[model samples]
Target: MTSTDSTRSRWIRLLILAVVAVALAHALDGVAWRSARLLSVNDKDWGRLLRSMGYLPTWGVIALGFWLQQRDHPQRSRYAWALLLGPALSGGVAEVLKLLIRRLRPNPDVFEYAFRPFADGPLSNRGMGMPSSHTLVAFAGAAVLAQLYPRARWLWYTLAAGCAATRVLAMGHFLSDTVVAAVLGVAVSTLYWLRWVEPLPAP
Candidate 1:
């Protein structure tokens, strides 16, 4: 890490951060401008089906992955922990931000999505839709898995893309919400890898 190398790295990091910020802003704008017209009129059921596919099921997937990894690669159990943490922490952050922001979902009268919580019968709960927690968790989990198994990067990324698309199709989340979720997921996973997972001893 010479002075020149350090400066270059800093510039690259800053450039990436700026790009992420712009992408997030664009996504948020899309969410704010979302409308029912985005759904297809010809086949509503198909849209709904596509949306349903995006559901991440964070806990079950993480637990299952951990269990399988422990059984198959006991020496690499630490990687499983790292994999699990990405979704867990990202979801936690999304949930807390949701509470604080109190943005409403597309369907205020009902909760149809996987991440939808029980309505507390309050006005504050009416507009609670900013960042898509499901999308964030889905991408986070995907990214962690991809990092752990570089050979399967395409598969993990495909899953993440499906999750993001489903969020919009299901009408459970706006495009912006899913977009921000994706960004957050990637950011969290990247930070974890650079700071922790990458530094671990090889198996």
Candidate 2:
């Protein structure tokens, strides 16, 4: 490999490591913060907003927008597909992990640890909080899209972080869960890019 290519690879690896470090720090901070009773009025309101944002309807709209944008940009269709796959795969993996882990949601009364969201009976799922699926899927989608469109990468990342924060504010997951999910999502997306997405043609 050329020296320039080697340097580029080193830079990419460093960036990925930096991202992972940040995610871990955030997760640790979140867990410690949540464990305390230090929530302020503003924090409560923000939590509520985040929780509401975590709802499917809001995410559905975002997905629809992405779909439409992809349809309009034929040249970027492949990247779009890869972007979609990230979330799909992440969600699938989360489901399997959920079943295997059998962890309960924060709200034991409202949500049982079941395969379906609307399962009957008292919510039995109450204690298996390891990885936040919402955060994972959100990051997966965001990472792929951001990689494809570097110009507006911040927007995508902001949205993903908001979604992840919502999961924590909603008390749907622990801080560690969201942190791990973000890392996993980005890792998977980066792997896909390296394996499949062709880099820009040499100048």
Candidate 3:
């Protein structure tokens, strides 16, 4: 296929995935929320820990550590740059969407479609659900790192998945929130990697 055709095809696939994700979110919100509630009753602590893995400080430290360790390596700069920038961009985008969309967190009192955009002002912390930021950050980091370190792609993606699961397990977001965020995170990081980091040398 021509480059233009390939790009169009990719966009079409993404559009289809978005449609499917929305449908799944609507159909499975109750089931997903209930399952999470059940599993998290006994595993809330574990879920919190996994969620922390995606926090800025947590992954920032990891990326910085890799950079420090690979100072003499050929792709150290690229790894460092991609790891830091990818997650930052992903999380930033998620945060903005959370504010703009302002979907309510999954709760017994609220259904999956609840929204309260700017209800408490732009800086409002309430109802800032949908597109779990934790998942986005985790997956963005995973996508970039996996690309840079292909051998450990499974490990990276597994950790990212754990991060995504934690959002549901904690009742912090609906299933759709994490699913969409996972896709967005990977898309953002992959695009960034392809446009900028892919040309860099790798060890």
Candidate 4:
């Protein structure tokens, strides 16, 4: 099978695994809470930087970076737009989940929370708290870079993970929330790149 096909299948399997992970984490929410408390830190500079990660202006910067790089490497222009789309694709899924799941999120002021899957109604902000949107976006961006820059794959993962970790610190997002979202984000983005962004195999 082609690389795209292989990657697509891999993400599908990852999705299944994500579900299992989410379930397990949800079952052990107390542990997730404890981990969050332990991992959290108080650093305004780091918190502010991480908060900007999922913001619109940040994505514009990301797009501009792509534009600059693509100018010199026109060959990459074909699929490079995928970088900008990366967060969008994964973010869209996260939003839908937020509306459906309506998971209760921990207050930024309060450093405690739990996973409330299927505990929320459509459009409810409560369930949206389970799979962190910030973490998902981070992973989505990382997934694209990981594919494009194979050599710097570890760096991309680090950035993605670090960004996700910030959510636990900034907002009382449980490790479970960030962890599950991180996995799902990468899985979704991998599938998107394979299905839409990547060029099809030459016939």
Candidate 5:
């Protein structure tokens, strides 16, 4: 297939995998709940580790990496916007969904806390759950890094997975919430990388 055809095919397959994942998350609710409970272990050390992944630090690293990577190329600035906007786009979308859905998070103190969907929860809680922004940021970075450093693709994803796990284990989000965020993170970042940031890797 031509490059265009190949890219389109990859997009379709990736989306299919995302959809399948979301469906499975719902279909296997019991397993997801159990897994979430098991993973929800509060640890100050773990929280500190995940803090490096918070919005500011995460994007800070992206900016620093972009700066360092572009130091050699003449058109390095050309990629600056894409690098900064990757997380913005991903978090922006996730934020909107969280508000629109108004899904209350699993109690950060109680893994077994009942999920409150669209209960118009506290204003402070609005846009706080459903799809996880942290996971989105992690996967967004992974998606871009996977394209930029193909050799370390798995490493990036592994980091993203670990980061996502912390979000759950720290009792910050539900399993389904992170799963949805992961899918969106991959989809949005891949789309950005392919259309504006970089060409898709050959299959």
Candidate 6:
């Protein structure tokens, strides 16, 4: 197939997968949430600790540490480009979507369908749950770290999945929220990597 055809095919597959994921999440959101809650009934503290790993600031700190360690290495520039910018762009896009959708969190009183599209004031804790920012950052960083450290890709993905799970376990977001974020995080970060980070001249 031609390059154009190959790209089109890839996009088509992504669209199909996204549709399927949304449908599945819609069908099993409550079931998945309850399962997570049950599994973490006695370990919510662990869930909270894992959840912090997904925070955007935590990602920034990680990238900073990586940069510090690799600064003298030859791939320093490339690592910096991918590690720093990938998660930032992923989290930024997720934030925009959150503000646009304004979906509610899975907190005690709120239901999943609660939304306030384009509301004026700042988003309260109860809202802005769609395409979770934490999951986005976690997965985005994982994608970059996996590429940079190919041998430990599984480790990176496992941590990212753990971070995503914490959201549901802690009732911070629905399963659908983390599911969508993981998809978007990997997609956006991969695209960013290809478009910008991948083209840097090797040192």
lDDT of each: 0.65, 0.61, 0.81, 0.70, 0.70, 0.78
Ranking by lDDT: 3, 6, 4, 5, 1, 2
Whole-model lDDT, model 4:
0.70
Clashing pairs in 6: none
Which of the two candidates, 1 or 5, achieves a greater TM-score against the reference? 5
**Clashing pairs in model 3, backbone N/Cα/C closer than 3 A:** none
For model 5, the stretches where C-alpha displacement exceeds 4 angstroms are 38-47, 107-127, 199-203
Top-lDDT candidate index: 3
Compare the candidates by TM-score and give the number of the best one.
Answer: 3
User: What is the model-wide C-alpha lDDT for candidate 1?
Assistant: 0.65
> Which whole-number lDDT from 0 to 100 does residue 177 have in model 4?
79
The residue-by-residue lDDT of candidate 3 on 1-203, one tens digit each, is 99999999988998898789778876888888776664453266666667775797777787788888888875557778788889999999998888888887877665647777464687765566778888999999898888978999999888888887777776777888888888899899999988887776765
- Candidate 6 Cα deviation (angstroms), residue 134: 0.5
Q: Cα lDDT for residue 163, model 6?
A: 89
Deviation (Å) of 148 in candidate 4: 0.8
Error of 4 at 101 (Å): 0.7
Model 5 agreement with the true structure over 44-161: per-residue lDDT tens digits: 6665565455364666667677778776764554355555677678988888887776666776444453544554463344536778888888788777777777899999888787
Report model 1's TM-score to 2 decimal places: 0.66
Q: For residue 79, give model 4's deviation from the true position in Å.
A: 3.6
Error of 2 at 73 (Å): 7.0
- What range of 10 consecutive residues in model 3 has the weakest lDDT sum? 35-44
Q: How much is 46 displaced in model 5, in angstroms?
A: 4.9
For model 2, residues 38-90, the per-residue Cα lDDT tens digits are 23422576555443332434445655666676676565555655656667777
lDDT of 4 by residue, 116-200 (tens): 5453444556434767888888888888778877789899788777777777655547667788888877877787887886774
